[model samples]
Target chain A: MKTKPLILISNDDGITSKGIRTLVELMSELGEVVVVAPDKPQSGMGHAITVNESLRLYKTDVFEDLGVEAYECSGTPADCVKLAKHHVLKDRKPDLVVSGINHGSNISVNVLYSGTMSAAIEAAIEGLPAIGFSLCDYAHNADFSHIRGYVKRIASEALRNGIPKYVALNVNFPAIMQGEIKGIKICRQARARWQENFDERKDPHGRLYYWLVGDFINEDPGQDTDVWALDNGYISIVPCRFDMTCYESFPAISQWEL
Target chain B: MKTKPLILISNDDGITSKGIRTLVELMSELGEVVVVAPDKPQSGMGHAITVNESLRLYKTDVFEDLGVEAYECSGTPADCVKLAKHHVLKDRKPDLVVSGINHGSNISVNVLYSGTMSAAIEAAIEGLPAIGFSLCDYAHNADFSHIRGYVKRIASEALRNGIPKYVALNVNFPAIMQGEIKGIKICRQARARWQENFDERKDPHGRLYYWLVGDFINEDPGQDTDVWALDNGYISIVPCRFDMTCYESFPAISQWEL
Candidate 1:
């Protein structure tokens, strides 16, 4: 039998999230899995890295029973990938990077705020084939049943074919019954936003406080968007890159004098 | 007499850093200044907000004698802006948002890892004109004299002309003496990156640790590039926008099928 592929796993919802458990369980059948993830949830920490302070990464046999190798990292999701590549897998580079199976959807503009997508993007920047997985629901007990087969198939295929170096995939599943999942759709990120409203409050000390709240608003109801894909009972796969140069508008913007 | 524009200021480096002090001092001449910034350094905290947890924002007497409204936030640069808009300034919307007289340059790929630029981006997303300023020097007491005039002129121009909605400016200065300050250059983002290298060490207990260390690699040296302008002793200005979609690639990518 051929040696197993080396698969590096990470997530924004920390090492103990149910999502990564399902992901690791699925990927275990495909490869030699190495898990390195944030010690706690880092949900919307877009591309953040712990630069100002010393980071603490500890090795433990946390998943020995799972028959997989795992380590916990005390940093953001992006830092986990970097640390994994540099030290955890020092001898050889991983064949692929897979982040999340996150509790909340990273469709549309949410990708701009996703620690999950940022991890995958960080991996892609290092020329690793990477994929980020998310579910539409934010519930702790969110279902991953509808996405397992698709996740395994897509991840294995990606490992087989090898994704283009600069591109990473952002995959989101609808929070529906397994049988209700229609199929998969490759689509663009929808033009959407979070209509923000902060909930104000007073602390026990009588000081004012506020909680950030927002409703996800889909400005683009077009069928070509990831939001539409999930809404229509299909999984969405969006190939993303991080060189955020709006090259098309360069000429128009270049006209401005300093 | 014309009212001085109300300019909100911040930085990733804690309020005590020379960066924000220089920014506050410079902007004071251009407008009525209000500062809401981190009490601690937040370098590499890209687009992070203080959610999923309680935040503590304290009004400080730092620079109190200057009569500028200054407060230190216990959150990321993005959070500072949100709190500023919602609670700090209940009377009026700020005329502009300015973040960073950063200790180091935030050109090219660095922008993706920047708290300062993200603060500017947050303001732009909130429909406020914004700018992020940086000095090429990373010294804690980096000299900012050479770029004071340029900072004032560009900021004043932005206040006068206003920016394209959803777009902000990222300005970087060369580490040169005040007299050697050649001129200002408006340019596009240069294609550059940090060639990542993680230095692995072993603790006394025989456990492994890794330090993320890297050198910046500039691939674009064109005159119209931000890096080139900064290198040529001219303050570099790159107009930035928050939408990360590569709309040009959408047509082709839309053709991909499962």
Candidate 2:
């Protein structure tokens, strides 16, 4: 009997989401699992941390399973990763940090606004190899069966061989039946955007309200992008990082008079 | 006389904060200024946009004395930039977007968690040149007599010559006497972070609370970093981009099996 790898799992959909439930089940086969995630849904909180407020973490039982430990955190996904590393796992760093089976896609421009991906990126900042997973559907019952085996295989492989420093994978799976699934394809995030549409409604108290609604528009028709991969029924895997400097432009600005 | 550049100004601090007010006042000398800032402070929001909630925007008379049009937005700093472009300044796109004279510095890793810098990044994403400014002191009325001219010069120069696409500048000013100013230096963001310390407190009702308090730990002491420039009494300017990809590692990972 060999000691298992300590795997830390987190999500943007709070502790009780079906997405994380599925993720936890798959991750359990790969290693010893510890879950630390937000208590409330944190959909679009990009790279946010709990700096001005106190964070409350509760010993939680999100899954009624055997041999797994979990805690629900009252903060952003990024905060969960930070606390998990420093406060929760003091003896040794986790083998890997995994975030999401996010309810929505974090492809293209959405990557900048994703709480799920930010958790993964934050883990990578602390020298932990990380992965953020998303299904291309926002519905609560979005099909994730197609991705279960692939997810398990991916995590198992990454643990066996370490990832590059300061980098994480943004993995998105197409929402389709398991039988119809195509093999996974390593891909780049497509250049895409949300065509903003805000719907206004009147409250019972005569106050105005609005809900964010958008149709994603992908202008990048390149066959190599993550968007294209998912569209063609393959899982998209884009390597993302925290350092956002466009170093190629460094020399061009150095010539400027300040 | 031809119309001056239409500059959109905002900050994570609420409309009434001294930081945004100072920014608007200084920008008034350089261009046609219009402010759309939060009605309440939104520190540490970190690229957060108000997508999940209704927005309330109302015109304010605060900047009428300076002959600048202003509005108060019930949203995050990123929302102010979006609303300014789509709803407020629909006729003409802003010549520039400027955020902050923040109560504290937004250098290095702080930029990753800054709503002030996020406002600038949002503007850069929208194809407008932008800048975020911060002072080292966290007081509401920190003496800011120094660096006023530098703000005017930098904003004017950015307007005079357009910035590179998808890029913005993060500028930090030293907290010092008016005559203690040095020149500006274009530099890279230093590798830095907050040593996480969550201050726990008890409410009057015996409820537990926490305030996010910590010391900033700068690990990089490179001579060409923004931290170095500010430490040397010079204004620090770091060109930042929204693309979070480490392109140099792409090819290496592309060779790996998916």
Can you write out model 1's per-residue Cα lDDT over B1-258, one digit (the tens) per residue? 988789999899889999899888888988899999999999999988877976677788897877888888888898888778877886688999999999998988778789999889888777788999999889998888777888887888788777777677888988989888787777778777666677768889987767778788887767788888887888887888666544444444444444
Query: Which lDDT tens digits does candidate 2 get at residues B1-258?
Result: 888888899998789999888888998888889999989888878877766678887789988888989999888788788778767787688889999988998888778788899889888877788899999999988877777888888887788777787788898999987677777788888877666665667879876655556677878878988889989988888889876755555676665555
lDDT for model 2 comes to 0.82
lDDT of 2 by residue, A1-258 (tens): 878898999999888898998999999989889999999999888878876668887778666574679989899998888778877786678999999989988887678788999899888877789999999899887777778888888887788777788889898888887877787777777766555665667889887655556678887888988889888888888888766655665775665566
| Predicted structure with the largest lDDT when compared to the true one | 1
Candidate 2 C-alpha error for residue B149, in Å:
0.5
TM-score for chain B of each model, two decimals: 0.96, 0.95
Give candidate 1 misplaced runs (Cα > 4 Å). A1-4, A220-223, A248-257, B1-4, B200-208, B219-224, B246-257
What is the C-alpha DockQ of each candidate?
Answer: 0.41, 0.51
lDDT of 1 by residue, A1-258 (tens): 887899999999998889999999999989999999988999889889888665678875767878988989888998898888877797788899999989998888778779999889889777788999998899998878867888998888788777766678898989988888898877888877565666777899999667877677788768988989888999988888776554444454455555
The local distance difference test score of model 1 is 0.83
Query: Model 1, DockQ value?
Result: 0.41
For candidate 2, the docking band is: medium
- DockQ, candidate 2, comes to 0.51
Steric collisions counted per model: 0, 1
Q: Could you give the CAPRI-style class of model 1?
A: acceptable
